[model samples]
Target: MPRLCGRRGNIRRLTRNSQLVQNRWLNRSAEDQLTDNENLRNQIAITRTNESQEQRNERHRVNTLRQRLARQRVTDTL
Candidate 1:
């Protein structure tokens, strides 16, 4: 009885969902939705890869500078 009453509650009434849910919800065209999901996943993967590459480049630059400074000190002491 409680479960039946709960189903009749005002909050249970359907309303227009927010934009994101509207876009990504299961009821839309399956092919288009899948494509959108794939594109989003690919973008995130590319972003992570680019971020990793940038960190690698920064680390390489720092190492190169450290090596050059060390060589200069050694040459000066000779």
Candidate 2:
């Protein structure tokens, strides 16, 4: 009999990969993490500077919504 592979199998593979990546990041040295964060902030600043006003507004709106939802989740868990 042939085995059936579907969404469940794909999800398991993805979850495993995500956990591995998270573990690697968590294991990185403090200095390496600091450097990575600085580079990320610089890239974000450069991208924001190049974005149009409309794009900036949309990004800000999305970010605000994300933060609100995140806060709701934390409150719900408390």
Candidate 3:
């Protein structure tokens, strides 16, 4: 007999005289929401892939540059 959201007896009372006058709220256009959802998903996926590629490229560039600088420093110091 325990209710779900910690309101045990409240839902039981509401069910007794329910005329269902609580479900009339249009928040936004469904088409706009759908388009927005699709756009967001695509943007997230593309951004993630671009970021991964950029990270890999940056690592390669940094390692290559560091090695060249280190070799030059060693030759110059010796």
> Against the hidden true structure, what lDDT does model 1 obtain?
0.78
TM-score of each: 0.35, 0.61, 0.34
Quote the positional error of residue 58 for candidate 2 in Å. Answer: 1.5
- Give one digit per residue, the lDDT tens place, for model 2 in 1-78: 656578645745667678899899889999998999999999999999999999999999999999999999999999
lDDT of each: 0.78, 0.90, 0.74
Candidate 3 per-residue lDDT, tens place, 1-78, comes to 645664564665565235353332235578867988999999978876778777878878999999999999999999
Q: Pick the winner on lDDT between candidates 1 and 2.
A: 2
Q: Which candidate leads the pack in TM-score?
A: 2
Across 1-78, the per-residue lDDT of candidate 1 in tens digits comes to: 564554466464554565557556757787887899999999988876778767878978999999999999999999
What is the Cα-based lDDT of residue 59 in candidate 2?
92
Error of 2 at 59 (Å): 1.6
User: How far in Å is the alpha carbon of 70 misplaced in model 2?
Assistant: 5.5
What is the descending TM-score order? 2, 1, 3
Residue pairs clashing in model 1 are none
